[model samples]
Target: MSDYCGGCRYDPKQRVGDHACPYTAGYWSFLARNETEFSGNHRMRQPMQGLHRLTDLDALVDQEKARGSIAP
Candidate 1:
């Protein structure tokens, strides 16, 4: 969370739920969609490591497909 987001209703730390931040959801979605390409890249390996830890990956994909809304 940033100082700028202090007044925002959505939580930057959340990945799913009604108040979930779109950026967070999109970021995880992007990583999941590109894990194979990022897996071998040392620069992305650290964040990419989280790809395997995710539970409802399919839901993240749905969120990505929704474009801006993080709902569901």
Candidate 2:
């Protein structure tokens, strides 16, 4: 089952699976394309912040590991 648009499926013939997964490249492209107006949007703001904070994934992972968040 596809997870596009709140777990709803779109037409496979017209759209690709990339549009289904929220983490897909196409999804980010969609978000980037629609970012300007979403500044005031509730959900978008936090993720935008997360996107900014996640720029250093490796360091975040290392920090989490240091904090015993990851299983060895």
TM-score of 2: 0.36
- For model 2, the stretches where C-alpha displacement exceeds 4 angstroms are 1-23, 53-72
lDDT of 2 at 8: 49
Best by TM-score: 1
Best by lDDT: 1
Write down the TM-score of every candidate. 0.76, 0.36
lDDT (Cα, 0-100) at 20 in candidate 2: 29
**Candidate 1, 1-72: lDDT as tens digits:** 549888889899877777878778888887877788887889997787687788867876786677653434
Under the 3 Å rule for N, CA and C atoms, how many clashes does model 1 have?
0
TM-score of 1: 0.76
Candidate 2 residue pairs in backbone clash: none
